[model samples]
Target chain A: MTSAEATAHYFKKAARIMDVGERIETLLAAPLREVKVQVSIELDNGEIRTFDGYRVQHDNSRGPMKGGLRYHPEVDSDEVLSLASLMTWKTAVVNLPFGGAKGGIRVDPIGLSSKELERLTRKFVDQIQDIIGPTRDIPAPDVNTNPQVMAWIMDQYSKYHGHSPAVVTGKPIDLYGSRGREAATGRGLLYIAREIARDVGLPVKGTRFAVQGFGNVGSHAARLVHEDGGIIVAVSDVNGGVKNPKGLDVPALFDHARKTGSVKGFGGGVPCGSEELLTCDCDVLIPAALGSVLTRSVAAEVRAKIILEGANAPCTPEADEVFEKKGVLVVPDILANAGGVTVSYFEWVQNLQHVTWDEDRVNTELEKLMREAYERVANISRTRKLPLRTSAYVLAIGRVGKATVLRGI
Target chain B: MLDQLMKLPMCKGLSQGEATELASIARESQAKKGTVLFAQGAHGDSILVVLEGQIEVSMSGQTLAQVGEGSVLGEMSLLGEGGKRTATATVLSDARLLEIDAARFQELLKTSHLAALKVVANLAQVMSKRLLAMNEKLIEGNKGKKEELADFQKILSNWSF
Candidate 1:
């Protein structure tokens, strides 16, 4: 299923568990706003290129909408809507005082020149600048976007409404961004793993970890786990994976990735296929790469006791079913990778307050929130005997429902 | 004992012979409370596995952490250069420790013993984690000062094009 369908599938499951009527479900499920704009930018070579940009504000009962703005060839209303609604639920899950919004321009950013990219970003901001603000809708980095992109969004929006830095998030740290935002998602994943280890009687220091996708989330999680004395035996990026059963040399692997731009040829470990890496025996299997990877077949082959989702929608309903049957604890993506958004919220707050926070402070605050959220979800899971994924959605949906009711919506 | 060794992350799922070879290098010591296992800056190279009781590890007169059974210490300096102890470890209670000789570990690793290699990997990781934490400290800054906090709304609302 596409991300949208998969998201709806999970939502329906939780809605059933909560037994909320169809009217409330439909009310919570619908978007608060949908924006589509024609973004026309002049290329460096004087060619005028037009891109379709969309923003989906899924909910705002609790607060303003918040999500990422990705630049990709496949950006569409459906995908943006699904991700937007996820942000609504995600913000609620983390107890952040924000709702959900996602915006994207349907363009392959890789093909754009720096000048063209800047023009496109500025133009997109001009179109939606009126709708987004510190207490309205906030956009952060996602997919093909980065901190530099956020910097452009902030600058462009500032032109329209003064130096309103809170209009966007994920900006460069020098440009009013939170310090720990870069490593927040991965750090959050590590924190969740630590909590899980504490409960499962598995000490993180010596446990075996196999991480899929060595991006920001995966690499940081691996480094932290390694530092915590967890043995990382297999790590993969888009190129492929490298493995060492004894334990991969994580520092060397990191250097290799830094130098070579991928983890596949890090000589410290033997070449391992992505399939092999996914199915490898490990105490913790973190899917931080692409979504829909853990299909029925892949999920059946998985040898992990716990799968910490570090990417968006990494598991399908079929895969989720297999894991549920086999008793593998799959921490949902909303809870597992909410660190990025959590820090985005922090960055926005810092921008609004005109006060910056250090990395350590940002991380400590993140830990407290993540741990508290984990406890809330775990308590529900334990008391209701519900799977973690369902429990998380139940918590999120319930919170959103309550907020909607209190707001008389 | 082999089963317990197998349970530890360092010696996880080792072959019987590999576990035996790893165990052979250990000099098990029993000490009373207040026993100093190793002192800071001293030439201590063996890895200490806390098999019984508790130990307090400290640096610069400040206690960093207290480790109980199944905790590994001194593995950092054992795998690190200079082989000098970086922290002081004192037994908090009557304790038993398996002090694995670095020379024997080196020999076993040279022979490519699986269990020895596992320990080395885990030790490197343990030290690398500590190094990362230190690196974070090196770059971490204090909180934003109250004096520096700007009146964001006032400043923005007063601005004109």
Candidate 2:
């Protein structure tokens, strides 16, 4: 299943656990509003192509909707609705003043030139410009979209009003992007693992960590865990993974992946497939790449004590059940990788105030939020006698429900 | 005819329970003149009958017709497979509406025989008028697009030769 669909599966499971009233169920069944606009763009080929772009504002009960805008041929309103709903739970778990929104165009962005992509992005923004703002709905990056895409969205939105950089996030650092934003998810995983280790009376130093994926999230997580004196015995990427029982040179592996764009053929470690990375023996197994990597089949082979989801919806509902049975501590993605949105929130604030924070301040503030949220989730897990994922969902759902009732929505 | 439909002719053999259900479904909403009530591509769930004032029904933002009190909008969008709002409904003046969800309204048809005939007949008449207008626009739009693409392809063929 795709990550978006996997996310929906997890959401259904979480909803069942929450066992909320019918009112909330009815509210969450479908988006509050789904906007489909004809985004007519004059392509570089001098042909006008009208793309069907959609913005599914899933819910704004807790606050204004916030999520990423994916640009891909497979992006549809249903997928957007799913992702947007996940965002609602995610932001609520992280205690952010936002709900959920997902917007995207049905186009293969890879085929388009930079200029063509720019035109398409601007036109898509123009079509839905009426309902979106910094406070209403904020758009960030997702599959086939990046900082450059966000910059274009912000620029187009600014034209209609003024220099409203806060209208979007996930821009380049030069454009007021947060410090440590790229590695925020990985960094948050390390913090969560450390906090868990401390709670269990295990020394953080020499703790074994197996990270699956060497992209922005995985590589940074490996580095951070390694820096914390943790032994990263295994790491993987799309090409393949590497392992060393003693401890692989994480910095070297990161550099090699950076140079080669894959973890295959790296010296001093054995190669393995993406699936094998999940089952590798380690204290903490971090799935930092794509979603649904940890299905029930692969999860049964996992030997780890904790599974920190660095990637959104990396573990399927079936896999999560297996983890529960195995007494594995499964930290849900919302609570684990919330550092990105937390810093994105900071960036939005900086843009609104026309001031930028130093990298040190940004990292410090992000770390503070991550640590505190980890403690809250951990405490809830202990008090409720539930899994960390369940506790996190409970806390998030309760917060959003209270906010909805307060707003009288 | 429009005003009488809004009043719903309760004296004409309409039962008390049926009248109550109809009134319960009726809701009031305010819109400034020229403000669109339902836009094209919107998920249309309700069929609205204007109780007061008038509205303009437009396809792709161009006015197709004007609908006044007791005139219903969006019956086809509700019953169609996609359930999309095919045309925009803009309030020409302040409007009060008795709107019913298409599904509930359909269910009501199964329960109340008298309501069913009136609703089905009214829906058929509204759809027929809309289809005729839509056919004219489709014919006009198709000719221009074909000629434009044909001219472009001809230029490309000549360049290749």
Candidate 3:
């Protein structure tokens, strides 16, 4: 399925359970605005290259829209729109005071030089600066974009809107980024895993964990799980994967990845391909990398008793059905990977107040919000006899639906 | 006498002899294009049947419909108590018209029971169709207002503030 269809699949499933009717479903699902602009930039080589950039302000009923800015070759209007609506649900699921919006450029960031990338970012900011502000749609880091990219966006956006640190989150710490924002998604996964293990009787101290995609989300998730005494049996990145049934050394793997730029050369365990790592020998499987990795076929081969989706839309609808039949507990991405946006919200709040929160305070506040959101969804899942993903979606859609209705939409 | 003038809208179920008897009383007349056969709110006591050419029905100077042969004009004035035209009728081209006075038709109904009953039934059916069309227009206009009021009720029930 296309990413848009997959996200809508989950939305419709929950909307059906809520019985919100087709009219409200259409209103809630439709984005408020879908904007696409040509970002023409003069490259460092003096060649003028124009790129397609999109920003979908999905909903702003609760508050201003908030989401990430992704820089990838596969970025298109459909994926951006899907991600934007997903943000709407994610923020509502977490009970944040913001709605959802997402932006992306269809050019691979890796292919551009530093100068070219900066010019592209500035031009993109110039194209959309009028629509985005601290109180409007705020952009964060996603996919190939990082703190440097966010910093550039902030600097360029400031040229038009003036010094507005709250306009963009996930910048360098010196440039107003939050301290815990870097590891928020992974840390949120840790908190949720603890809660699930406590209920399922699989203690975090000994639960075997396999994480696919050891990037910003996967690596931190693995390390945090390892620190909690969970066995990190397998982990993978885009380049390669590593596996050890006895548990790979998480810190050593991090070192190896930092030096060699991949997990392929890690000496702690057997080298595995990224695809095989999904069905790795572990009790808990975390697909924190790309979306749609867990299809019907993959779910059939998956032996993991619990699946934590630290990536957005890692499991397709068919895979979800397969897992349902097999009784695999799936912690959805809106709740699992929502830590980043949750912390980005913190950063935005801090920027708005002209203050910086300490790392400990940031982590504590994040844990509190994460726990509350999980408890709400878990209670509905247990009582309603619905899947956790559906439960979370139902809760999210209910909140957003209420907001839209109450606000006179 | 124009045979087509016997085909008045209110004479739908009348027999050939009955229609010819009614047409025998209609005084034939001719008017040029753009002539006002009847006007909105004007009192009338006769129903005119168009035998040939087109006539335009309008309201407040806006043309509502362009009608041709076999069309009836001012039928409502004969049936309604006020005997006032609801809309204006203007001749679109030089045409034939058969004007039947209301008092003469009333006198004919006294002697012809079956023909009067059939004509009254046909007029009632036409009047009912126009009534239904107006009802539909009323509903269409109120749709937005209904939706807005629904949203208000929902909020009033569920909204705390």
Candidate 4:
């Protein structure tokens, strides 16, 4: 199934479990707004290029829409819709006062000069400025976008609306961005992993982990886990994979990856295939890369006792079924990777109040929220005898469903 | 005033004698709220360090950064070959500032090599820290550029575009 179809499949399952009526399911499943804009920019070579950009505002029953703006070639309406809907569920799962929205531009940002990139960002903001704002829809960094991009958006937006920092989150710290926002996702994953380990009676001190896709999420999760006494056995990036059963030195690996731009040539571990690293022997397996890596066959071969999803939709429905049969506890992305958005919410609050929070405060508040959400999901899972994924979906669906009904939708 | 200058990051390692001597050459200044310390593109011969309250650095009426106590402003102009202010600095609040004339400071540096070396070293450290911070922001900004480019390339390989 397509990514949008897959998201629908999960939503349908939760709707069935909750016995939510067809009207509510249809209302919740449909996006509130899907905007497609044509972004044309003049390249540095004096050539003009046009690209398709999209913003899918899924739901706003909870609060103003909040999500990221990704820059990629395949950022079509369907993918934006899927991710936007996921954001809706994600926010609800963590009980944040926000709905879901996602947008993306179909361009390879790396190919653009800094000036061109700035112009493109400003133009995109100009197109969607009417639909998005601090109280309307707040955009954060996602995929290929970061603080500087957000800074550009904030700057461009402020030109029209008088110094409004709340229009976007994930801006530079000097631009009123929150501390600890960058590492929020990885830190949130660590919190979830700790909770899961305790529930499964797995001691973190000796637990082995193999992470696929050593980007921000993977690297931070690995480093945090290693600091917490967990043995990170394998880590792979787009370049290649590295493995050491005794635990790869994370700090050294970080330095190597930074220098070489990949973890492939690190001296601390043996080289391994990226695909093989997924099903490698380990206590916890984290797919921190792209989505749909763990299909039926790969899930069947997976030896990890637990799969902590660090990336969005890393497992297809078929793969989830296989993992269910194998008794491999899978923490769904909605909960496992909700940290980024959760902290994005914090950043939004700080901007709205014109107050900045210290890193320690941001982290402490994030831990509290992640832990609380985990406990709620875990309690429901045990009581209902459902998978953690389903329990999370149910909890989120129930919350959203109640809000939808109460809001007289 | 010397004690306050010693507390600033830019004056961290200066000896008491050195700080006192530097303080003698420095002039204490105050600007009320809404006062512009220096306009963008203007020639700047002094570096102002914030002693109390906040100063906003802006360009074309857009506020870029706010430097508070212990933060130095106009260093770029002092260090730049053109010696022209890149951004306008305005007092955000009634503020106390220590203004060090670039020429006077240079004269002090010429007279006392040890003090000069220490000040130069401290300035280098400050510039390095700023450069490192900017580098980090750029890296963070461009974190997924390569991976996303690869994603775009894969799409192109599959499609005729």
Report chain A TM-scores, every model. Answer: 0.99, 0.95, 0.98, 0.98
Q: What is the DockQ of each candidate?
A: 0.00, 0.01, 0.08, 0.00
Question: How many residue pairs of model 2 clash at the backbone?
Answer: 0
DockQ of predicted model 3: 0.08
The TM-score measured for candidate 3 stands at 0.79
Model 4 docking grade: incorrect
- Per-residue lDDT tens digits for candidate 1, residues B1-161, read 56666667777657888888788888788989999998998997678888899999999899999999888886654454537788999999999888888777777778887887777777667668889998777655322222112222222222210
**What is the C-alpha local distance difference test score of candidate 3?**
0.88
Give the residue spans of candidate 2 off by over 4 A.
A1-18, B1-161
Better of 3 and 4 by DockQ: 3
Cα error of candidate 3 at position A152, Å: 1.3
Better of 1 and 3 by TM-score: 3
Interface RMSD of each: 19.6, 28.4, 5.9, 19.4
Off by over 4 Å in 4: B1-161
For candidate 1, chain B by itself scores a TM value of 0.78
TM-scores, in order shown? 0.71, 0.70, 0.79, 0.71
Clashing pairs in 1: A205-A229, A227-B129
lDDT of 2 by residue, A10-90 (tens): 655555665554445566656788999888888888998888898988888877788889888987888888888878888
Off by over 4 Å in 3: B1-161
Order of the predicted models by TM-score, top scorer first: 3, 1, 4, 2
Where does the lowest 10-residue lDDT sum fall in candidate 1 chain A? A400-409
lDDT of 4 by residue, B48-96 (tens): 9898999899999899998898888876534434377889999999999
RMSD of each: 31.7, 19.8, 8.2, 28.4
